[model samples]
Target chain A: QKEVEQDPGPLSVPEGAIVSLNCTYSNSAFQYFMWYRQYSRKGPELLMYTYSSGNKEDGRFTAQVDKSSKYISLFIRDSQPSDSATYLCAMKFNYGQNFVFGPGTRLSVLP
Target chain B: DAGVTQSPTHLIKTRGQQVTLRCSPKSGHDTVSWYQQALGQGPQFIFQYYEEEERQRGNFPDRFSGHQFPNYSSELNVNALLLGDSALYLCASSEYGIHTDTQYFGPGTRLTVL
Candidate 1:
């Protein structure tokens, strides 16, 4: 199985809609789960990170990690065109330096 | 506070050539990690450096190497590059010894290998 898996979505959503992005991993040992957003011609910007299970919310973004299911999610509320970009899920083992990234999901938010 | 910065925003090279990309990490951060992102793909881990030493590396070949300086800056060197090396090379910075320190990324250098 792939270490990390995400739907390479070209998901389209209208303005003010709720957008949900998710990823699953085969490795149960991953402790740090991160969500990154990348615009065209730009490097990834870290959106949110979760240490273990449960949910974390910041502004319009909310991240959830369920270690038991090896699943993680990012929810964007009231999405705007600016929120359109490639969303990537990355995770790493405890005390490990490298991150294993899943194939990003491309999102397009329409005005 | 300045964020992580990388130089030569774009580069072009041919097969079998060598390229060196530089990075200045975010201030107060001592660890630097490199990643390669091809078109339509997520960034792939290249390696990490701390204390001017290589701490961890990914599955890339030996032709891909890196060096860290005392000032917490770094360089990624690709020897005998292949067409597949065409991608955006990113440098990320984080503090050492912090289990949960977030990595701040630079804008990245785009390399096109023909």
Candidate 2:
């Protein structure tokens, strides 16, 4: 099994809606969790970052991690058309250097 | 400030041919990491370079190699490339020794192996 799993969602929602994207990992040792946004033909941009299990908020984006369940999520409030992109979850062990990224979920917020 | 920059924005090569891609890190950043992103997938870590040496590597094969120059610029070389090697190659830079460092990525080089 792949260490990390995420729904390859082409999820579409209207503007002003709330969006939730999630990922699950098999490794219990992962301590650093991150969410990245990637537009078509562009590199992944770091959106939210969290250490261990907790929630971190930046603007309209909120990242939540549940270490016990090995599940993580990113919530986008008042989603906009500009928010349409692929969201990726990445994690790493505390002592490890490499970050493993999940197969991203594609989102499209329409007007 | 200019962000990370990669050369040869797009490339096409035949299977078994070699390819070299280049990257210059962001200003004040000393560490560089390379990633491969295939179609419909997220980027996968290839390796990282710091202090002119490879600091970490992922599960890539020996055919993939890299170099870091004194200026902190880096090169990724793939020898005897296979069709599977075709993917978007990204270069990310971050400061070493900074706790919980965030990587800044460049517009990746799109590599296509025929």
Candidate 3:
């Protein structure tokens, strides 16, 4: 099984709606969880970052991690057309080390 | 400040041909990491360079090699490339010794092996 698993979602939602993107990992050693946003033909941008199991809020994006379940999630509130992109979850055991990335979920917030 | 910069934004090569991609890390950053992203997939870590040496490597084959110059710039060279070698190559930079350092990525070089 892949170290990280995420649904390849082409999930479509209306503007102003709440969207939840999630990922699960098989490696319990992963301690740092991160969410990245990538637009078409662009590099991935860091959206949210969390260490261990906890919740972190930044602007309209909230990242939640449950170490016990080896799950992580990114919640986008008041989604906008600009939010349409691929959401990727990544995790690492040590700083500046190799990070495992999920397949990513494609999201489109339609107007 | 300029983020990580990759050269040859796009490239096309034939099977069995070799390819070299270049990257200059962000200002004040001393570490560089390379990743390969296939179509519709997340970037896969290839290797990382710090202090002019490879500190970590992923599951890639020996055909994939890299070099880090004294200036902290890096190069990823693939020999005997196959069709599967075609992918978007990304370069990320971060400051060594910074515990919470997040990697800043470049626009990436798109490689197409024919």
Cα lDDT tens digits, model 2, A44-86, are 8889878989999999999999999999999999999999999
Candidate 1 residues A57-103, lDDT tens each? 99999999999999999999999999999999999886546888998
| Residue A77 error, candidate 3, Å | 0.4
lDDT tens digits by residue: candidate 3, A3-65: 899999899999999999999999899998989999988889889878889999999999999
Cα lDDT tens digits, model 1, B1-114, are: 999999999999999999999999999999999999999988899999999999999989999999998898999999999999999999999988787787888999999999
Q: Local distance difference test, per candidate?
A: 0.94, 0.93, 0.94
> Chain B TM-score of all predictions, in order?
0.98, 0.98, 0.98
Please provide TM-scores computed only on chain A for all of the candidate models, following their numbering.
0.97, 0.97, 0.98
TM-score of each: 0.98, 0.97, 0.98
Q: What TM-score does candidate 1 get on C-alpha atoms?
A: 0.98
Please give, for residues B10-88, the per-residue lDDT of candidate 2 as tens digits: 9999999999999999999999999999999989999999999999999999999999999999999999989999899
Q: What is the Å distance of residue A57 in model 3 from its true position?
A: 0.7
User: Residue B53 of model 1: what lDDT?
Assistant: 90
Deviation from native of the Cα of residue B21 in model 2, angstroms: 0.6
